[model samples]
Target: MIVQDQANDFPVGPEDTSASQATQDQLHKSYRMPDEQARDPALHIAKDWVQKKKLPDMSNITDPQLRRYATLYPKLRLTSDGTLFLEEGTGDDQRLRLCVPAALIAEVIRCLHQHPLAGHLGRYRTYLQAKRRFYWPNMHKHISCAVEGCTTCRQSKERKATKQVPLGQTSTKEHTRFAKFYCDLVGPWPNARGPGTKKYLLTLQDAVTKYPEAWAITDATAENIIRVLTNEFFPRYGVGMTIVSDQGRQFISTLFQHAVKRLGVFTVKTQAYEPKTNPVERLHRTLENVIRCSMENEKVHPTQWH
Candidate 1:
């Protein structure tokens, strides 16, 4: 059945409030409020509607396309002449539309001069860019970074980003005066550029001094590190009272621990898998900055950290 503004087609003239089958059906299904998935209350409503077969009211629905749903489900109900909304459930909260519809969100945005949560949205974007495997907005990948909901693309569409871990570790670099140290190994850098059978950089940092020391290696075997400490590092600095490094093979080797014990030096490694535990991580950042600064300032790549 088709409805029109003219009473001739709808059969209900200005005098009568009564409506034709087509007019009532169209009005009933025309309510096209967006389903908000991020809001728990909103998502709960959508979930209940979809799973339990509780459909929205279809009376006086103004949207022509959505009115089609009324034809599909006769059980759906509607009221308000298309203004307010009410539904029935055992509980007051369940029966009510706890969430504002997507249409309402746009309306709110339009009415308000500024949004209260707008400042926090940039941080959310950064988080989305960094991590790509997160199940943020439950919708299918509809937006870049986060397409879960239009919160970007609400309902039926979502783009997930990765999850970020909260390791929450930092170095004592800021507190001590050359007291804390961080050490790590970098590279089995490919030997294609220059024909070295093996190469690595054993990096060390002074927490307070912010000074970094690099020891290049052609071989990174555990024995090599023990030998380096005995030969190069130990002789100049003496054994540090508390040294921090990662759980790499060289650091964890029984030989390294024994050597430290024999030297009467205490050793502390970073929390397992937490890179920030070592102050030297900052030094690595500095080194990268230096490389970048040199490239920009000098217009030539500085030699790689040898």
Candidate 2:
């Protein structure tokens, strides 16, 4: 016979020995025992001992659940109305946690985990909250499974760590000062100045000596890049044995390629989306910081960046 609590619409009676059709349906949906079983037999036995103010005789208790209760007898408590509780802590910090049966374990966890105030906390936090109010065998394990299986958590929570391949070294032992160069373009600064009101910077760094250079230009076109490399850079530094750059349009343009080829310089482009493959990328950050600090110290407006 099933006894229902009208006020809360919850099942309060122990389950009948024969499973009903509704019970089977609920089992299919949740894979848990029916809600009709509010009291486990093991807990009932423990409650009897608690009410009588005596310890249970565990020697003959062969049932696994009953044996489990026997082991927890020291912390078990019973109320006058037959409700079972597990006592935790001592003295002023004492707490009585309701001993929940297997049938209602899922419901309890669902309410605690999905509560608006609870805000769908992770496994350990949900376990801590459940532990404060309810007691059950392997409570942490149950809560962990519930939290892990939650669709909302799986969909919304970001992974704690992302796997990535280690960065490959770009320099070799045979490299020397000015022999290999890493080059990139930086900005269209909001503040434009100098001849042609230059607003962009073309930066280059030596792989071996770590030497760096930059030139301001009005645009990052292939023509401007070729002019900087052929007329200024190659003449001063001599044609680099090799130059590493990103796959930007200015660097990959036919004009830029032909100019480097004629100078007898081998050009290598870094892999797409892999900035670390070009060492000059790191120099950009330091360059920006130094420029910003110098401008502030000299009270020079960024328009004079050229």
Candidate 3:
């Protein structure tokens, strides 16, 4: 209200004095400032200038860090009893507000966001609650970041792929490193490549680490499937003790069954049409989302996932 407009070098004119003082009085009565800023050195200096007429010469205020607070001195005010306030917003909507220290911003954001009546509400609602009583630079950015990173909001509010079934009984069993894996097939996706115009993605996931590997294949033949397992996967990670896959033709074929047995790896097939019995099926949604977002962000062809 009756703030020193730091941008201006001169004192207030006589005509503006009464109205400005009245506005300041109204604000002081309507809202209370937080006590935290009273101990803040920057605010102490600001208050000295605004309320006690003790403005220190720039050179005398030796802390270079204080310059940031000094710059805001003109916009800060102190009530008759010495509570610090900041003049914010614009005319008709302009008001004095409690100043929040940098250290307390996160706590303030959490309190407002998780307030019983307002918990899990979106950004704008949380911001309004904060703006009503607190004033800070880049307050909106702070609020937005806090709300977006909220764990509850991420888990419950955000849209995600529907789960087909609970994590399978096999998934709950402890898996030894390089001993158990979940395998699945994804796509007849666009942008087919390689010999036979590859269109399918063969996905393998290590159950212990949850690490996944994928390869593009033109067909789901038992020969191609066995080749991926023996040549590509087995060589790098060593032969797993057990391999789990949906009961697709390629997985259940005589060629695949014999090939895995010869390699000393046991094969377990999921119940018919129950893809969730193989853990890798759950990862397909996440994998597709990753590829879709990457293509959108990088301006690449959708088939680039191949």
Candidate 4:
């Protein structure tokens, strides 16, 4: 009965078997191993010890390479086909990572990084992909060097210029509110028929509390700026000790300087082109965005922004 069953299982009368044979051949070609891990000199000692299930004592091992394998024996596992793997992680998260030899580390990294799926990613990302299936000493360092030396990446990627100057301290010893003020002018927007036909905005920001105030004016002249500070700002918040502003013509004018001096407030002009030194520049961006949104919501023309 057993012989009869085996004979029936086999193809006794072959009929149109060419397609089936081709499919079987294709499957065998696709499933074969890419390279021979047994031929790697670095993993030969570990493979032998793992196969025998007997690790020699590290104290008596004279060879440096053999001693290294002895140290890692607990984590090493040998496959039936002689390939070595490093057992990593714990419990449900555990993985068997192929132990790559030193000589093949660069080739493996190149394959992973330059592969169409990899898209030539950065060092850390490529290292993460490699970590999923390969194990080697100083793997991160090797991958980093490989990425840095890649001619394609060097030629294609844009290098960002780092800021040379460090940030300057902006905090004051006195925590008093309204102790310092950052002042700047925004626009000459489209002329609108508001109070004084307002087209420009004079903005002031408190250094301590960061409280901001703005006034619309017809022009950005020194006289107009001084008039606003004297009539409006000083009456409400009182005079600040220090006034920080950029080197605008109005801020640095002799008339503007005299006006602040009368109030016993020191005026500081920022460097020629460095607006970052003044905190009010940041306030301008936020204020402009708010104005833009409000205009859009109200269906107001640019000329009627005031």
If scored against the real structure, what TM-score would every candidate get? Answer: 0.38, 0.43, 0.47, 0.43
lDDT of 3: 0.67
Worst 10 residues of 3 by lDDT: 6-15
TM-score of 2: 0.43
Instruction: Please give, for residues 1-306, the per-residue lDDT of candidate 1 as tens digits.
Output: 111223321122123221122222233355333223323343334334444555677675555433433343322222222111222234432221112334333333221111221211222442332122111221122223232223321321222575998988764436756565667877665431455443676787776776778777767777777777779887878765567888888888898889888997778877898887776775654444333333343344333534
Please write out the lDDT profile of model 4 over residues 1-306, one tens digit for every residue: 011211212111222233222322332354322134556665776777777778877677887666766788888865444556777777766656667766667667876666534556678877887777677777898989998897666654545675798788855675878888999998877546566677889999988888989998898899999899989999987774888899999988899998889898888888889888888887776565446544544567767776
Against the reference, the lDDT scores of all candidates come to: 0.46, 0.70, 0.67, 0.70
Which TM-score value belongs to model 4? 0.43
Alpha-carbon runs more than 4 Å astray in model 1: 1-176, 192-198, 289-305
lDDT (tens digit, per residue) of candidate 3 on 1-306? 244432222122222322223332334454443345566666655666776555567777767546555667777766544566666667666666666666667866776665433434668877876666566667899999998897666654536566698765543576477688898889787666556777888999988898889998878788888888888998987764888888788888999998888888888888898776777887787666445534443466655655
Worst 10 residues of 2 by lDDT: 1-10
Show the colliding residue pairs in model 3: none
| Model 2 ranges with Cα > 4 A deviation | 1-172, 193-195
Score candidate 3 by TM-score against the native.
0.47
The clash count of every prediction, one per candidate, is 28, 0, 0, 0
- Candidate 3: where are CA atoms >4 Å away? 1-172, 191-195
What is the C-alpha lDDT profile of model 2 across 1-306, one tens digit per residue?
012222212122223321222322243365322222335676767776666767656798998877877788888765433456667787766656667777778877876666533556678877877766567788888989998898765654444565898998753685567888899999887667456878889999888889889998889899998888877898888874898999999999998899889989999999999988888987776566446534443567768865
- Return the lDDT, model 1, position 30: 52
